[model samples]
Structure formats: C-alpha cells, structure tokens
Target: MKTKILTMTIYKKLTTKIHFFKMKIGINNNNAGIIIFLSVFFVSFNTALSVTKDSITYVKPNEYHGLLLNDTSNSIEKYEIQRLNYSTLYDILNTRNELFGMSLGLNGHYNNFLSYGAIDNNIELGINGRSLTNYYNGKYNLENYSPEFFERIEILKGSDAAVLSGHPNNTFLNFQEIIYNTKIPFTRLWYAQEGGSFISADAIFSQNFSKGWNFTFGFKKMDDRLAFDNMSTDYWNLRFILRYNIDSTSSLSISDNFTNNKTITSGGSDPEQSLNMYNPINSSPYYGKIQMRNFRHDLNVTYSKKMNFFNITNTTYLTSDINERALPRFDESDTLGNTSNTETQIGNRINLDFTFDNIEFKAGSNINTFNSEGTNFFTEYSGVNWNLYSRAELKFTKSTSISGGINYGDDSKNGFIGFGERLEHRLNENSSIYLDHSFISKNGLIYSNDLENEKTNLFIAGLNLETIKIEGYYRIVNSPIFNRLVNEFYTEQYNISDYQAFGGSASYREQVLTDLFDKNDKIDLRLQTRINVIVGNDELKNYYPLFTFNAGLNYMLMINKSELNIGFKAGLLDSKTAPRFIPISNSYITTTNNVGIQTTGLNIYSIMKLGNAFVKIEWENLLNANYYNVAYYPERGQIVKLSVVWSFFD
Candidate 1:
C-alpha cells in the first residue's frame, strides 16, 4: 500500500468512536452498492474485512457531533486498511501506542513520533479537514505514500488533537484518501518487489464523468537500494481528484499532491568508525558525495456544507517546498556545494459546527503565508501564521459528558494559548469512560527567537470496549522543542527545560477462528492483541522504548471467486537510546551519545486472488532480526515483498 500518487490523502477511521473531523471513515454511500464495496479498495477479492460503514454515516465512535467526545476515552488509535503487511506510513505508525522510534530510514519521511511532549515537529497531520503540517522539517511525506493511498489511520492523542487544523499539537496523525464515489470506469494496476534493489509501482483511475462529477487519477513509483553503503533511493507520485457533489449536503473539491525525491545519503554512521556495533560506518568523508533532493506541490481547494443546524468546512492550499543539496565542500574537497531551496505556502482552513440538544459546538481557523528562497549561499525567510479555536460540549445525562477547549495563535510572534478539560462516561452498551486535563502551547516557524511557547501538561485516562481497549497517560513538558546541533552541519530550534512522561495501553480484538467449529464455507479468522508501557524522566526517556508490543493474526480463505489471505504481525521493542539522526536537518536528537535497541519484529503476508486480480506476498524481518532506530541506522534485514493489484471496470 504505497502510492499516494499525485498524493492527496485523507480520512481513515476504520472503526473508531470519536468525533472532531480527522475524517477517516466517512464514505459509506449506503446505497449504490458502493461499486461492490469499492472492489476491496485495490485488492479486489472481498470476503469482507472492511468496507462496511453504516452505523450512522461517516462520523463514528462516540457517534458524531464533535464537542470533545471520545466514546469513553481511547484518544483514538485507528489503523485499518485491510490485509496489509506494512510498507510505509511509518509502518502502521510504528510500535503502536505512544508511537515509538523509527526514522532516518525507510525512505526517511521522518517520524520518530511521540508527540506526547513536544519533540521536533510535534506531530500534526490531517487529510480531508486539510492541514498536512510539514512546517518545514516536521516531515510528512508519510514516507512516500502507499497503503494504496490511505483509507484509514488515525492516531489522535493528547491535547485532544487540538481540534485538528494543525498548529496546536501533541500528536494528531490522520488520513483517508481513496477517493471513491465511482460510477464504474474504475482502473487499478500495481506492481511491487522489495527484497533487493527494491522497486514499487501503482497506477489508478477512477470515475463518474457526469451527474455530480467525480474523477481521480494516480501514479506512484519507487526504486531503492540501500542497507547502508553509499545509499540510494528515488521516488515519484502524482495524484489528482476533482469532485463536485454540490447536492446531498454540498461539496466541491480539487486536489493535487505531487512528489519527487532522490537521495544518496551518508548523513549518518560513525559509531566510532564501526567495528561491528552490529555493523555501522558511513563516516561520510564524502563516500556518497551527498545528494538529497525533494520536490513537492500540494494544491488544494475544498468546500463543504451540511446543515440541519450547522457544519462547514473550508480549505484552500497552495504549497511548494523544494530542496536540493549536493555537497562536497566545507573547505573544498574538490569543490562542490550546490544548494537550492524554495518554500512557498498559501493556506487557509476553517471548520465550524454546532448542535444544541445536549450542547456541542466547535470552531476553528488557520491561516498561513510563508516564503523562503535560497541558492547563492541560502538564507531568506518569511512568515505569517494565524489560528483560532474553540470547543464545548455538555450533556447532563444519557450517560454523562463534559468538555471544554480553547486555542489561540500568532506564529508571527507574541500570542499563544491552549487549554482543555474533559470527563465522559457511558460505561455500558459496549462501554466507555474518560478523564482528561490539558494545557498546551506551541508556536511555529522553526521557533527560538524570544522563545516562550512550547509547553505541555497533559493527563489522561481511558477505557473503551467492544473488544477491549485501555489507556493511561501523564505528561509534563515545559520548554520542549529541540533540534539543536548547530555545528556538525546545521540545526536550530531549541527549547529544552522540563520533561516527564508516563504511559499505559492495552488492547484486544476478536473473531478468532470464527464460531470455533463447524460453519466453514472456506473459513475466516481474526485476532489482535496489544500492550505498551512507558515511563520517562531524564528528559524524554531516550525517545521511548520501555516495552512496546504487538500481535496479530488474520486469515481468510474462500476459494471460489478466488480468495485467500493470511497475515500475521508480531512485535516487541524494549531496550532504548535511539536518536541521533540530523542529516543536514532532517531532525532527531537526544544526545548523551549512544546507540542501542532491542528488537523482536515479525511480519508475514499473503493475499491471492485470480479473476479480478490480487497478489501480495510479504515478509519483513520475518525472523532475520537485529534492529535500531538511529545511530548508524540499522533495521531492515530480512525483507521480501511482491505485489500485483488489478482492476478495470466500465
């Protein structure tokens, strides 16, 4: 699942019960056969494991009408894109709960994610509701798109996702982009082979030429070769969408997300010139000559209206970020220092909602206009960022509720604010429970001038059930924000002060072997389990790793129209001290100088189908262990992949 071609991703809430945009599981169309459930989204052969969203259309989990509702607290952790076995998007958001380590590799779109207490970039991303928060160096190419361009993935935690519009953050990673509302005319073709010399591909085309209009087109590509040693990578993506649903609540859209990146890095490696710290030594004396390039364009326009009372969404974007660096010159190592940088942005975002009965209201705003230029010894900056927010929710009964929020901004200096409170209960009918407290303030534009905002203090509790879930958290961050490293190349934005962390997570899923006996018209099974625990002090606990877990097993076999799928995922992350990547400011630091990581990872995949096409064969780490999240950048040992997706219907 890798091409976010022409890239443009949005929505992804496979099955969550919370509200506040972050749109992830919203297209259920209810009728029209939904093109036979979206042809399994790109893998065809459906024995059904997804594509069912009827509980009340779109918004789920706590069931609609945002105003701080989290269906009894699980702060959101949605990630389902059926039958997939990792390939980007931080591999299904790394180690799950609390997001633990992994960056500087796997295409380096960077995400050591653990925004619980401000860590460079502080996490913020969304689709549909706009805002992909890259604010330069916060990284968000989601590692060159895939997972078939998204259909699910939400990770909202803390600061209650700040009502999501970006800018205010503690983590809120959202997505949903598999633009469908087709009226036939579908087309899909894909290819992949990743074990060595890696290569991947995808091509898509969607429909609806008239009557309301809907169109989509996509293309994605990738080529890689690297495990360390000179390094290399190449990528491409192109996506397009045009929609006009002006009826049924209203809609209008236009999108384009383009990508092009080429790399040959040696930004790391030098664990004392490697003599086997599990093999590491890039020492870059100029080994690869350093070439890092990136080109991007995200042009968007959106409008939405749905009313009985109120609902409005507005998004306007124009972004272009270009970077080019060709090194080999710090004193002339043969003279070569080519630099090119261009950054442009024009953004606007808005979301408003209202409900009266038990009370609920939401409001949001975001504005941006930034510019940068370089080439000729680079250095040109510009800014203008704005934001506003509000939230409220009350319910005296019907299972209780309470919420509050406030946010204010002014990235051009002198203004920042954030606060929150929550309490909810619903302990029955499939469970619910929550408790929260927050105080956050984060300002942007690569900060550090006057330096004052980058604070966080969150405390949370959780419980949710239908198949079990649990959460617990405690956090404290005073200055936070860091990216220091001012002399081994370049890096800035520092704020360091107080830091503390706490954690908890529990999970369970069902359908294990279905009915347990008999009733086998070919079979289907499911099982999932999770656990995560964390504790921190000494500033960020070395970027987290106190015990992170995973377990999964899903199988399906329905041989007739052709079907078979088997997937299993296993995990464990214990030892820590992983952070030290900066490669000309890609970011990740936690100095005290050291490197170590304990690993136990596994991934297996299989999906087979014939007529309409489907084939996915995977194996990542599958026993060939040995891991690391930074420092010489290890991880990536046993790899195997093969994909083939086909579809074409008129």
Candidate 2:
C-alpha cells in the first residue's frame, strides 16, 4: 500500500512538472485557440471543393480491445489468415512475450532491446527512423513509452520487408496511428491492474464534427514495479489526433504525442553463483544507484488524394527526444555521473500510386534530417538522407503476379542502391506461393567514422495455405558490423568481412474438436515454430548463436459468454557470446567464446474474458529451468502474474 502511494505521489509530482513546462513553453489559452483555429481552417479548406461519400469507413473502437480479450480473428484476417496472434499490452508490460523476430534483455528496470540483421552498429545504438528502432548506447530508451500510445503494431517478418521502407534483410515494426471518426460523440475509460504492483489508467474522447472533421484525445498513465528488487517503472503519455475527409478519394490527418517516463536500474547477479543448487543466491557484486528520465514529443501529418488514374500521399513528421541518466558510484571516490542526450529529426515522404491496364506502379521518395548531441559524446553529429524507390507490379493473370522494385539512397556519409523482385502465385482461393530475392547496400551510421558501408543478398521462398504458412530464407552479408563488449559497461563494434545465415519458419492454425461439438462450441488451436543457423569464415561463432529455435502454441475455447485462451511458449539458444550486466552503465556487456551457457525455457499463459473485462494469468519459467541468455545473468525463477482490465465505452 505504501509503495502504491509513493508511486502515485511521484506521478503527481511529474505531472505537475509537465504542466509547468507546458506553461513555460507558452501553451496558454491564446496559443491553444490559435492551434484550434488553424486546425479547423486547414480541414475546412481541404474539404471545401471535395465530394462526400454516403457511407463512412472507420476503425471500430473495440477492434484493438478485442485483441486483449484473446480474440485473434481480426488480426488473423489482417495477416491474410496466417497463424499470427495478437500480443496483449499486459503481456508486454510483464515481459512475457517479446514479440517475434526480436530479442529483449532485462537488467532490473533497464532493458536492452535489439532488432536483428543490422550491419550498422551505430544505427542500433542511436535512433534509426527508417527502421523505427530507437536506442541509447545499446539500451532500449523507447521502452519508457507504453504500447497503448499506438493504435496497432504490425510485425513484418522475412520477405515482408521487401515492401517496406527499411532494409529488406531485416524485420520491421510499424507502429500505426490511431484515428477515430464516428457520427456520434464517443468516450472510453479503461483501467488495468497487475499483481506486481502495476497499474494503468487510460481515457479516450473522440467526436466527429460537421463537414467530415473529426478529432480524438487520449491520455494514459502507468506505474509498475520490476519483478526483481529495487526497480520500478512509471510513465504518462498524451496523444491528440485531428482528421479531415476532403472527399471520397482524399483525406488528411495530423497527430501529436507526448510522453514522460522514469525507470530505476538494478544490475543482475552472477549466474554461476546464483544458479548453484547448494549455494544461496547472492546479490550482484557491482550494484549501484541508477535512474533514467526520458521525454519525447512527436508531430505527424499525412495527406492522401486519389485522382483519375493515380493516387498521391504526403507524410511529414517531427520528433524530439531527451534523455537524462544519473548513476551514483558504489565507491565514494568518484562523484555521481550525470549524462544527457537530445535528438531531433524532421522527415517527409511523398508517394504516388498509379494503375495502367494490368500494371500497377508505386513510386515514393523520403528525405530526413536529424541532429543528436550528448554530454558524454566528444562532439555532436548531424546528417541528412534521401531515399527514392519505385515498384511495378505486372498482373499476368488473375492467379499470378510479379512485382519488382529499385531503391536508391544517398546520405552525407555514403550512397547505396538496391533492387528486389517478387513472384506470387495463387494456388487457390485459400493458398499461395511466393519467391523473392533482394540485393541491398546500406550506408554506415553517420555518428561513427570507423564503420564502412555494408551489403547483403537475401533469397526467400514461402507458401501460405490459409491457416498455415512455411518459409525458408538464406542471406549473405558483407562487412557486417558486430557489437563487442569493451569494458564492464561499454561496447564497441567490429566488422565481419563475410557472414551467412539460413532460417525457416512454419505455422499452423485450425479449429480443434469441431466434429464432436457445434461450430460455436469448438476450440481454436495455433502453433508456430522458427529456427535459424549462422555461419561465417571469421571467428564470429563466439559472437553470435550458431543455432536458435522458438516455438509457441495457443489453445482457445469459448464457454457460454466467456472466452479462455491458454498458451505455451519455448525458446532455445546455442552457446555463444551472451550479454552480462554492467551496473555502472545500467547496460549489458557481451562475453567472449562459448563461455556463455546454452539456454532454454518454457512459459505458460492464460486469458479469460467476461464481457468488457479481461483477466490474464501468466507463469514464466514454468519448468523451473535455471538458465541464462546472457552470461553471468541468470534467468529469473518461476514468477506468476495476474492482471485485469476493465473497459467502459459510450
């Protein structure tokens, strides 16, 4: 109870500070009115001479909420009826599911999150807008923001990146925006609670005005304690969206978001000592007091119009991020270390889509400029990049299509060009096959002069059978940059001349026991599996896993008016260099050789939905396995969490 009170008090104080900051920034009544007037005028002008459609198309309020209730039907359909499931926000908060194609490391409150298949090590450390990956010195600074801030998260895996804006060899995550348009005023209130002293509150208000004008405002606050000791997380966020329908073929949307967050770091323990059956778990040797404060603001505007034969879209965004960290040394000799980093970026994208007879064309260009500075860095860095891409799809028949694209990018540091081709054949209404190949050259990070440009070649083939999917891929990378632990708390990058990787994934989904029961009384089953193997001429084996595998299953049933979803997930990793905690920096350092232990573990979860309320229970490390993904950082023991979310809408 006291802890809860303290968390609330801290939140209140932070909110007060933010309010004062807003005042200092002159967000007073005058500016507020001006903003409103400009928004209204722009929307009005855009729709002045446009045609209105009789029917309105908009996202339903409960679409995302249904996912939290274990209803994956909509998401499955969105993914072309593939075997992908929606990850609930509760699961993310508890670190139960890190999503597919990504890995997450936990050091108390500090999180080291990384996306795979990036050759530019500096891009992993700094903010990379092209890929939407944000980090600070290899630590995931974006973890401070809650997933609720976004309308939806789309996971693009394997060859799916061929159509996206990022490197074709790596997976991409797209955080979609939220726009609400309804004939009547709508409001929603939500509250969620978890066993680990986690609490979240949210409110959303939206309305559709005359002349196809709509607006929405959303606010969220979250407070939580880490599963381990002396760690906590807290954040508050606000989002506003303004949307206008110019006509049946045109629309414009503007969104703004702000967030403030704080987290406390807790260094991990030594695996050898802690995992010993005969010895008691010992505290981390290099424990220190560390805290990080993060503030972020983003503004985005999008306009789309459809002409007689072509469609055009323009999108612009501006983002500002500030982070501050304070670390008190364990010893009294050194003074407290304080560091601050600030980054700002402005970017714009224009795309044109046209269709001529059986051929469809898409052309787009993106330009971005970014500047970053940090107290610990020797000097500030700034860069500008321009990317142009064009794609054409030829429909030979109703069942087959071939598409190809070429991309050229130039930056202050380097220039690169790439091309890809994809052939998709529909076997039937419920199945299809596709083959794709890509060759891409990526520029090095602007902040690092030591790194060189990198290139990759990827080939992928896949089959989709409505409820099942199978895919295989092979990739070769030249001058791949890999991260190496420099000291207890820092990492450096080294280039690998040649590297190769092969991987495959398969998934299946079906309704089970339907023959014995009615259609409405049947059970739903889902299974997904993936494996990867890496090889290289250099001694890169010690730096990366030789083999890795992941498998997951979910079984869902409906009883009366309630739904139950039960799931199990497992992961396996081959011996390789693994991360270890560095208390001083509140980050992780990698180990050399195969000294790191090969690790495996199983996790289980269940969700029950009754009306507008959902209850989720999760048990991590169900097998009580004693393993470590990172060296000297043992995995947590069996931990159970129960969470509940109640939503009300009108």
Candidate 3:
C-alpha cells in the first residue's frame, strides 16, 4: 500500500543520517520495577480492544473506528485509527497533499474534521455535550498533544455513523482509555513544537478502596503558540466521576466535566473584508486575546442482572448544555466584532443491552434541549433547539452481525433526521468483509426555513486482511449529504435548506522488519480517495474529488547504550474543488473557480537519546510549498522545528 512505500523512504533516510553509536546506561532493579508497572498498566488498557464481542457488540471493529484500533502497530499504547491518530499524521506527510475545493482537501480553513466521526471512550461529546464545532474552527484539531498520556485514539468509520447526530460520517474520540481497574494514578507531562510550541499535562487517577465504591478523576491542560502572529491558546479540561456498585449487580454514578480556553491573536491582521476592515486602528501592529468557557454535570444510574440464559444491562443519564462562544473586544482593527455567547443544555439518556446464546441486542435514546444565544456584545440573539438520537443492534452469530438505528432532532435553525445500518462478516482470524448504509435529512438549517429537508443515501463496502507481519483494510463509500436543486444560482440555493456528499477511502499497512533491539520494527502504507458529487439547485454546483496516498516507516535500534528512533514520511494529494471559504452566500456566485492540487506537505523526524534527555529534530514541508488553507486564507509555507523530551521522573 501507499503507507508502506512511505515507510520505505523513511527507513532509507534514517539509515543515511545516523551511524551506529555505542553508549550504555545502567538499568537498576528500581528501573525494572517501574518499567514492569508501566507495562502492566498499558497492557490492561489495551484489553479494552479485545473485550470479546460477546461482552459488548455495539463497537464497530477496526482502526477506522478511531486511533485505538491499529493493532498491527508496534507501539503498544498508540494506535493510528485510520486517519485519526498522530501516527497517521506521518502517513499523511509521506503522501501527497491534495485540495478538493474547500469541502474536501488536505487542509482547509473550515470544520470538515467534525464530519469524520468518533470512537469509543470518546463518545458523542461536544462543547458541554451541547454544541459541536468543526475541525477548521480549531474545534477538533489535536494541536500539540503528548503521545504518552494517550492509550489510543480511535477512529470509527462507515457503519459506526449510526452512533452520531448533528454531524456526518463516523466519529473520532480520544481513548484517554487508560486502565481504570488500576489502583494508582498516572501523570504525564509532554511538550511539542511544530509551526508553534505547546506544553501539556494529563493525569488520570482511579481508586477502589472498598468492594462497592470507586472514584476517578481526569485532568488535562494544553498551551500552544501558533506560528501566526498572536495566535496562541491555553486550554483546560477536567472531569470527576464517582460510582457506587450495589453488590456487582447495579451502580449509580455522578460526573462533572469542565473545559475552558483563552486565545490571543498576535502576528496576523483580521481579514481585509471582515467587519474589522478599514478600521483606523489597523494602521498599527497589534495583539488581542479571547476567552471561552464551558462546563457540564451529569448523573447516571446503571443496573445489570443475570438469570438463566440471558444477561441484561440498563443505563440512564441526565445531561445539560449545548454550545456557545465568547471573546473580549480590545485592540485596534475593530472592537465591534468582539463577541460573547452563553448557552445551556438539558437532556436525558437511556440505554439497554441484552444477550442470548448466538445473538446480542442493544438499544439507546437521547433527548436534549438547548437554550442558546450569543452577542457581539452589540446585537443579541436568543433561541432554543431540541435534539434526539436512538440506536439498536442485533448479533446473528459469532462471525456475522447486523445493526441499525435512527436519530432525529430539532433546533431553532434546522430539523434533523438520520437512519443507518451495518453488516459485518468475519471470514477468518485474518480477514473479513463489511458493508454500511446510511441516510439523513435536514430542514430549516442555519436559521433558514425556505430550505427544504435534504435527503442522502450512503453505501459502503470493505475487506480486511491480516498476516503475521502485516494487516490492513480496503474500502469505499458512496453517499451524499444533500441533493442538488433544480435550478443553479437560485435564491433558494443561497438559503441552504439542504446539501449532500458521497465519497470513500482505501488504506493498508505492513511490517517491513522486526528484531530491532530484536523488537518489532515496522512500516505502514495507505491510499485514500473521496469525492463530493454536490448538486444543489441554484448556483452551487460543486463536484469535488480528492485523492491522497501516504507511506511511512520508523525503526528503533539500540546501538551501544542509547536508543534511536528514526523515520521519514511523504505524500502527494490531488484536489479537484474550489476554495473552502467562500461564504455560503457567495459560493459559486463568482465565475473565478480556484481549482488545483493546492499544495503538498512532507516531514522527516528523528529522536536520538543523549544521556538523560532525548532530542527531536523535524523538517516539515521541506519544499516550502506555496499553499492556501481554507479559513482566513492563511499561507502555509515550509517549517522547521526542534524540541526535547526529558525524563524528570526517572
């Protein structure tokens, strides 16, 4: 596959740059104990992946479900779920970067990232589980993250789409999926620098002091400085969970979650056409900051009973909050565009699970009410929206299964309808084939009712193959989010009552060698292609085709006493679409169609151990390709970064 080719390139570069060096550090008994403890904790966390379908069947299989599923990768705690994980980041680098208009591309300014999907442990969580943001909006971008704190990043693809609402495609959720059964808390401090610099800290603490009581707490903080002038952020997240087990048959739990962010704009100026345009203050260089806050609390109760040949689990939960954003007005360009927003969401969830001899059953429902509105601190907007989601699953046999579900919701702006089904057949231990189908309808979206409900149908099929040294997948999907309008450039088109998209991707992986330190050394390959055949009445006639091929390989070798991890990644992309940022009102309204491959990206990185610290050097986008990203039309040129990770605890 493509990823393998990329890996080959990485290996060649690594071998050429570094010669074998000998250095030795003594490992005492204390170091052995620590390594053992960390290893056990990591293995336990991985057990979540092998929990046997008989225990829980709702989870979609494979890494496409999220980063948590890359079973073939040597990194025990890090799995690249398709395109969702950081490991995949290297895969993308090894391939070509393509542009498909704004709707589909390697890098666009908008939020199509939100459209992908989530995995287990990640859940359908949004800002307070009320409102969801697009990846381009800085919503889902991983930004700067430490690979150590994460057990896995899961990416659910195709069939898993049934578990989501208010968004399209599968879901992507961070596992943070640490081993909860462990007695001790784990803390990790990580730092990384790309076009910017970032520092992060994460801690997951859990305890079971008695037979029936347990406590768990999670905390995370991330601070990153973007390359763009004044573009930097500080983000914080915390969650507390308490549980009471009633004699192993039932449980009650209460949880609280909080997230806050502060943003500073430094180097770049506001867009020339924005409200800030032509402001007298624009003459001077400046910097400004914005702050956003969100909080959520939930209470849940669960009951399980086993009798005769059947087992059942019932869970109920209450949630509150939706989506809102706020920012302070300060510097020059324009204080008028300064904004503030506050919103609340209240809702309930009920889920059920049933198991029998050859089949398992599951069902769930969700209802949320959003009281949301925001202001530029100038104009006031207020309204409410109602949202709902339901699901059901059925297992036919150990090797084959099918599941289906529907979701419906409404907000002041739009009405939603979604339907989907999945079919899976395991051919053997190493191979399987699967199919997925989905449909969705939307009306009165984005504060417009003149728009009609848009309807879409999606079909997907894929095969998975595994071997002693290699495992991977190949799949494709055909579906559209909204259909086309009868007339082009019609006023109705501007209204955007509905839209549609249909496309698919194919990927693969293989292990080139093993026994580095006599441990497994590896390579990965991937190829993906997607297209949006968009047909909306009026002027919006967008047909976007995007193709990406990526490959990468990393080898770890212990020469003397120090360890060295070297890798290189590269890729190529072909994009066939317009720029992503033209306002909906002006999309296709202009005759100038910006179409091309857009740009490409490449990165080569090496990690070398020098005594107590590790040095990392990376050359990103080595060619310094000229590219235009979707939002705000930011220019992305080549960047070089260097950083270090020190073992302070050890």
Give the per-residue lDDT digits (tens) of candidate 1, residues 442-529: 6445434656677777887888788777777777777666766666655767666666776667777766565333243233333332
TM-score per prediction, in order, is 0.30, 0.76, 0.62
Model 1 clash count equals: 25
Report the candidate with higher TM-score, 2 versus 3. 2
Tell me each candidate's RMSD, in Å, in order.
25.2, 10.1, 12.1
| Index of the highest-lDDT prediction | 1
lDDT of each residue in 398-461, candidate 2, tens digit only: 8898987887777667777777888989898878898888776764445545777677788878
Q: What do the candidate models score in CA lDDT, each in turn? A: 0.61, 0.55, 0.40
TM-score: which candidate is best?
Answer: 2
* Descending-TM-score candidate ranking: 2, 3, 1
Q: Please, what's the RMSD in Å of model 3? A: 12.1
Candidate 2: pairs in clash = none
Query: What order do candidates take by lDDT, descending?
Result: 1, 2, 3
Candidate 3 per-residue lDDT, tens place, 1-650, comes to 44345445534543232211101111112222232233233324323322332221121111211121212222333423212212212222222111122321211111133232110011122321222322111133232222333345333444444344334334423332222332332222222334434433344455554555556665555555444444455655566656555543444555555555444433133343344311323322122433333343333443444444433433344443333333335555645544444444445444444456654454445454544353432123334444455545556777787877676666556667667788878788777777777665654224232555545555666666673222122212222222222232111232332333344444555555667356534444434444334444222343343444555566666656576777766655455433333211112222223445744566677777765456666777777654433423344345554444433222
The whole-model C-alpha lDDT of candidate 2 against the native structure comes to 0.55
